[model samples]
Target: MNTMTVTKSVVMITEEASFRIKEMMEHNEEQDAFLRISVNGGGCSGLSYGMTFDQNSQENDVLDEQFGIAIIVDKEDAAILEGTKVDYKQSLMGGGFTIDNPNAIASCGCGTSFKAAARPAEEQPCE
Candidate 1:
């Protein structure tokens, strides 16, 4: 047996979110797809997290897999998303992917956008 140990990364996916994503993908029946987690300008906070499916990924996109799901984040956004957990909660109010980011210095109460430790201007670098 090979002695090299695999170093697993820590991208968090809450149980509810996993179930929801799986159901959505299976229901949609689109094989050429992935969950795109990203950050873009505009929100109650200085910046905001963007989640979508089946757009396009730049060549530099960082690919990750966790909990039987594929994740795609831009090379730059990877820094901001590190150590972050994506979760979904069906609270009576609503439900969505919650970012549990250790890097966030401040986050909006709506749980959408956040300011990183460096607080870079709302300018998302051009691809």
Candidate 2:
């Protein structure tokens, strides 16, 4: 896909979050790596969000740019992640990145896990 087409899509990355991501990239000497975002199963909430630095993009990936960073997301994951925003916050305890996903119906107390409407809860057999 063309850069212009990818740039038109919306995926927000706050300035503070961008700074931290860039810092990590610099620390690892991965200047050419892009931020890869994905959603996987097996969290307490049935799904979890994962972020990592990847040097390659798959053919089915949806590439976008935000705050000067290349963000790649799987085509399947993109549908559930639309209108998501990521930010970094510093508190008395420490600083960490936070993800706010509008499409989430539920989230675990730990904050890294979430439940989306697309993945309905399955009934477990009685013990």
Candidate 3:
């Protein structure tokens, strides 16, 4: 079994993203909560990223803190999320969060949907 350790910096959040997260937490009355990151199936690209304020974390969750904010990522989801960067951008259209995941093989136009990089054994030529 591989015993590689996941570093706390596996996922990086920009300064602007950190500020926005803090603001959101203050708005939701969850300032003391952790920012939970996850991925789930069923999106247009077969996977979707999720984020939410959580009061508690699971036993196997990986915990990290940056820019004064706490974050929690599931161990299983870490592989797909590793090397991901979270940022906040402001524009005439307003502000929003952007995710840049290096492990994504493809992404849907909707933006939140993605297909993770497949393992070697799972890679096969398309018919």
Worst window of 10 by summed lDDT in candidate 1: 1-10
**Tens-place lDDT digits, model 3, residues 1-127:** 1122334766899999999999999999999898888887756677777999998877678878889877888888888889899999999999899999999988777676778765222222232
What local distance difference test score does each model get?
Answer: 0.69, 0.80, 0.80
- Report the lDDT tens digits of candidate 1 across residue range 30-127: 44576778778766667787777754556667776666766777768777878888888788897766678898888767666668865574633322
**In model 2, which residue pairs have backbone atoms overlapping below 3 Å?**
none
TM-score per prediction, in order, is 0.75, 0.86, 0.85
Question: What is residue 110's positional error in candidate 1, in angstroms?
Answer: 3.7
RMSD of each: 6.2, 3.8, 6.3
Candidate 3: C-alpha lDDT:
0.80
Off by over 4 Å in 3: 1-7, 118-127
User: Per-residue lDDT tens digits of candidate 2, residues 1-127?
Assistant: 2242364444578999999999999999886788888888756677878889998888778888887888988888887888899899999999998899999998877665778897665322222
The list of candidate 1 runs beyond 4 A from truth reads 1-10, 122-127
Model 1: residue 23 alpha-carbon error in angstroms:
1.9
Q: Candidate 2 at 73: error in angstroms? A: 0.5
The residue-level lDDT of candidate 1 at 1 comes to 13
